[model samples]
Target: MPGETVQPTPPGPAPVPVPGTLVVDTSRGDRLGEFRGAAGPYWSLRAVCGGVEWEAEPGAVRRATRKERLHAEIERWNARSRGEVL
Candidate 1:
C-alpha cells in the first residue's frame, strides 16, 4: 500500500431544478431554499427567507414537497415581519 495511488470520487449526478424553485437539501438538515443554479459540481441554494447561499450536492437536493413549500413561504413571511428578511 505504500506505493499505491488513490483516486478522487467524482460528484454524483443531481437533479436539475429551475431557478427560483423551492427545494430541500436533505443533507443540510432538510433546509429549505430556493434553487439558484448550478455551482460547478454542486447545486446552489439559498434560504427562502433570503440569506447567504450554500452549495448542496446534487444527490442531496430535491424539489420541496407541497408542505415544505408552504412552510418555507410561512418562514419567509415571518422573517419579513420581523425585519430579518425583505
Candidate 2:
C-alpha cells in the first residue's frame, strides 16, 4: 500500500434518547416531560401527568431532577383524586 491516501470517515447520525426518559425543557420554562421519541426534527414529549404532548428541540431539554419527578408524581396523584385524570 505505498503512496495510498487515507480517507476520512464520515460522521454518523445524531444519537436520539429513548422513550420514558424524564426530562426538563428549558425552552418551556424548564417544564418537565417524558421523552416519547422523535417528532419530525424535534423530539416528542408527554406530560408526566399523562396530559397533552409537546414537541421540543433536543438541545433545549435535559434529564429531570429527582425533586421535579416527585413533584410531578404528586401532581398526578392529586389530579386523579379530583378525577381530573384517570
Candidate 3:
C-alpha cells in the first residue's frame, strides 16, 4: 500500500444528460428540445425556445443532429434577440 498507486475509482456508465440538455425526439419529426427527465412511462422534453414540456418515448429521443442543434440554438438566440425570451 505504501508504494502501490491507488487506482482511481472507475466512473460509472456514460452519464445521462441532465435536464435542460438539448436533444431531439426522433419519434416526432426530430423535434429539438431540452431533456427534462422521465414522465411516468415516457421521457419529457421541453422546447429550446421555452414552452410546455412534452412527453416522448425514450427510444424515440436522442442527441440532436448537428443541424437540428444549430437550428434550436439559433431559434433561442432569435427569441432572446427579439426580447421574447429572457
Candidate 4:
C-alpha cells in the first residue's frame, strides 16, 4: 500500500563465538548450549548434556557467566550419572 511504513529487521550482535564455547540463549529462556558453529544468519548450539543442535540469533545469545557455566557442568554430570547421556 502506498504511504505505508515498513520496519527493518534489527541487526544481530557481532563477534561470533568459537566452537565448544558455552553461551546462554536469552531467546530460549536462557538455555545454555555449546557453540557449534554458524548456521547462515544464525548460530548453532548444542545442549551441555549433548542433544540435537538448535540455532539462535546472535543477538539473543551471550557468553555464559562463570556461575552459569558451573551449573551446566553439574547438570551434565548429573545427566551422565543417571545414564541420560553417555
Clashes of 3: 0
TM-score of each: 0.74, 0.70, 0.72, 0.76
TM-score of candidate 1 on Cα atoms, chains taken together? 0.74
What TM-score quantifies how close candidate 4 is to the native fold?
0.76
> Pairs clashing in candidate 2?
none
Model 2 accuracy (lDDT, Cα)? 0.85
Which candidate should be chosen as best, given lDDT against the real structure? Answer: 4
Off by over 4 Å in 3: 1-15
Q: Which ten-residue region of model 1 has the weakest summed lDDT?
A: 9-18
- Residues 1-86 of candidate 4 have per-residue lDDT tens digits of 99999999887567988898999999999999999999899999999988899999998999999999999889988998898943
**Residue 70 CA error for candidate 1 (Å)?**
0.6
Model 1 C-alpha lDDT per residue in residues 1-86, reported as the tens digit of each score = 89999999997666588899999899989888999999788999988877799998988888889999889888888887888835
lDDT of 3 by residue, 1-86 (tens): 67988889985533466887788888889788899887666888888978898998776777877887788889989998899953
Give the better candidate number (3 or 4) by TM-score.
4
Worst 10 residues of 2 by lDDT: 10-19
Stretches of candidate 2 exceeding 4 Å from the true structure: 1-15
lDDT of each: 0.87, 0.85, 0.80, 0.92
Task: Give the TM-score (vs. native) of candidate 2.
Answer: 0.70
> Clashes in model 3: which pairs?
none
Can you give the lDDT of residue 24 in candidate 1? 88
